[model samples]
Target: MSRIVFLEERCKGCRLCVEACPAHILRPSGRFNHQGYEIMEMDGQCTGCASCAVMCPDTAIRVFRSVKIRNTAGEGAA
Candidate 1:
């Protein structure tokens, strides 16, 4: 699983991240932040692709990827 964090105060409500997200999980919050701009919110699963972070002009988005560990001994390998 992936996690996305947004610095709402730094966002300018440009919607660039929203359009850049391939997962289509980003959307406007319909409310303004401290800067009086409509902040972005996540509404779905995040793939940790960093599309939104890369597209964000204000660098308000952050993506964290989960690392999965598999048990090799669980299979018939021995």
Candidate 2:
């Protein structure tokens, strides 16, 4: 699974990230940030595609991907 982090203070509420996300997981939050603009929030699971991060004009979004390990030894033994 992938996860996304947002720097609320740096966000300008441009909604670029929201439209850029192919998963449709991003949305504008009703609450206002310290800068007085309504920030964006993740509403669903992230695919770690970095679409939102690239579209963010303020560079406030980040995507982290999980690493998976495989059991290589067990497969050959059988």
Candidate 3:
């Protein structure tokens, strides 16, 4: 699983993230931000590919990938 963070205040609501997301997980908010632009947020379907992050001109979005842990005992048993 991965974590997606959206910085609404910094967003310009240009829909660039939504358009760049390959999974189509990002959506426009119904309410506008202080800048009067519709905010963009990631939904549950996000794959964490960072496509949106790369496309965002304002650099308001961040994607964090979860680290996988391996059991040392299991490796010894193998």
Candidate 4:
């Protein structure tokens, strides 16, 4: 799974992330940040492709992925 964290105060609300996100996961916060910019965030449907992170001009967004592994033992297992 992947998660996105938005740095509200650092955001300039330039909409670059919104345009860059292929999944269309980023959107305006509708509220102003500490810098008075309409921050952007990845919606619940984000696929975690990191498109937004690359396009953000202010570098206020970050995408992180978590890797999971499963182990099982069976009769045929070595």
Greater-lDDT candidate between 1 and 3: 1
Sort order, TM-score high to low: 1, 2, 3, 4
Q: In terms of TM-score, how similar is model 4 to the real structure? A: 0.80
Q: Write the per-residue lDDT of candidate 2 for residues 1-78, one digit (tens) a residue.
A: 899999999999999999999999999889788989899999988889999999888999988997777768767674
lDDT of 4 by residue, 10-45 (tens): 899999988988877778879898768888766777
Best by lDDT: 1
Better of 1 and 2 by lDDT: 1
lDDT of 1: 0.92
lDDT of each: 0.92, 0.90, 0.83, 0.82
Model 4: lDDT of residue 31: 80
Best-fitting candidate, scored by TM-score: 1
For model 3, the run of ten residues with the poorest summed lDDT = 69-78
Q: Model 3, 14-77: lDDT tens per residue?
A: 8888888888888987877898888877677667789889998999999998777876775656
lDDT of 2 at 32: 83
Question: Each model's RMSD to truth, in Å?
Answer: 1.9, 1.9, 2.0, 2.4
**Full candidate order by lDDT, most accurate first:** 1, 2, 3, 4
**Candidate 1: tens digits of C-alpha lDDT, residues 1-78:** 998999988999999999999989999989899889999999998999999999999999989988878978769865
